[model samples]
Target: MANATSGMAVNDDCKLKFLELKAKRTYRFIVFKIDETVKEVIVEKLGEPTQSYEDFTASLPSDECRYAIFDFDFVTEENCQKSKIFFIAWSPDTSRVRSKMLYASSKDRFKRELDGIQVELQATDPTEMGLDVIRSRAA
Candidate 1:
């Protein structure tokens, strides 16, 4: 497993790059574990999330892991269009976790995120995921 410092460095690099692009109207975000340390950083950067979900654990075909999703919204002043930011956390190992972020303005991209997870779940034990897991937690 990678050291905590290295993991944090990776997260920081991604966060910095996201901010740089965000200033130019490009919003790109990366996901990382949500430990106490990371939680503080996230709150500082994006303020409170519009919505957040608790950890959902499941036994995947390849491994057992926990997942959580967070959503943040930014409304453009000119058009009041809402741009979405999604942060997904995946922990394949109890001791190590990683995450991914999606910045989207279209419904298609949002559907794609859910579709990807649905496919993964289908490959594993579907019962491991609650019926309302994705809809209630993510949407």
Candidate 2:
């Protein structure tokens, strides 16, 4: 997992890698969109979400946005470990999908069960998904 305090830039490659991991089922992910059509598509693609936060909100560096947090889980082989994936969907308009963000981490990192299952979860902060942090750097 990357360090949240390091101020890393999110890029297309990272997004692509996330999608690839989702496809491979290496980790689970969720989609947050107010549009019913888009939500339906996401449900069809990713299956029903494990949890949903309809009234979620986050404070960004430049502004505050009302968003929804969709959560999912991925259990490692033999139910050894669990991973939590969160998808943050910012809906400034409340009528469509606008800004999409993603965060994923393991439930536990430094511990393993007697069966030799290790939990390798990552830590993240909402500020890392702030618009100023995610905006195109070229500008």
Candidate 3:
């Protein structure tokens, strides 16, 4: 569904892929991009279940705005393994202003379409969403 506030639509594939990730653990992460010409949010990349966090990080462009969801697994201080679904808004400083604005505005609506997100993070650089930060949040 598209939201008038953001002037962007979330493709059905976005939600479908999210469900697949959340329910089946089929993906380690999913990156979403707003297709300017289409005025809609679409799946730009899917990280394989076996992909590492570094691989997911590499999939993002340095000068672009993207939405990503990562299935982060970590061990708690109590020695229990747990996973948290992280919803990340990637808005690099080098990205186009228009792109950044559109993504920032559209993110919430797009995120709302996907259920079961346990953590929400907005990052302008890699360090902001680093493994350490994710681990802390998962804790």
Candidate 4:
């Protein structure tokens, strides 16, 4: 998820470890931090985080700046079909580490798809998020 504020869509082509954006001079990658607990929660809450490879590729981004897609593949599927009934811890020590770090799930609301991973966290728009601004002329 790229928390995009404008009408930008990820190019539906190309498959690489990372995505490069030329327009805004940025780059993104599909990174995954395997958490058995988080995976289980996803399957229960969002219904199976794993999607068909075809579907995943269809939402990929081309070598353009418009947008990029981060595809996260599951190396293990032990909790793929299970629900939150299990003693799963989503955040784990991951949350205690830092608060500013933005991961895949953190950007879900802004992101369009569920399978892709967002290696680079998008910049937060001040106006959109609603924050007071005070500007002063140079003394």
Instruction: Write candidate 3's Cα lDDT for 1-139 as tens digits.
Output: 5688888998999999999999999999999999989889999999999999999999999999999999998888898998999999999999999889999999888888999999999999999999899888888
In order, candidate lDDTs are 0.31, 0.29, 0.93, 0.25
lDDT of 2: 0.29
Give RMSD (Å) of candidate 1 vs. truth.
14.1
TM-score of 1: 0.26
Better of 3 and 4 by lDDT: 3
Candidate No. with top lDDT = 3
Q: Candidate 3: minimum summed lDDT over ten consecutive residues — where?
A: 1-10
Question: Of the pair 2 and 4, which is ahead by TM-score?
Answer: 2
Return the lDDT, model 4, position 101. Answer: 32
**lDDT comparison, 1 vs 3, better candidate:** 3
Per-model TM values vs. the true structure: 0.26, 0.20, 0.97, 0.18
Clashes (backbone N, CA, C under 3 Å), per candidate, total: 0, 2, 0, 1
Cα misplacement distance, residue 13 of candidate 2 (Å): 29
Query: Which runs in model 1 stand beyond 4 Å of their true positions?
Result: 1-12, 25-80, 92-139
Model 4: CA > 4 A from native:
4-31, 34-89, 94-96, 99-101, 115-139
RMSD of each: 14.1, 16.8, 0.8, 19.8
Write down the worst ten-residue block by lDDT for model 4: 130-139
Number of the predicted model whose TM-score against the real structure is largest: 3
State the lDDT of candidate 1 residue by residue for 1-139, as single tens digits. Answer: 1233323212353345344434443423223222345431221122223223322222121243223223333345465645433334332333323322211112123223232122222112343344454344333
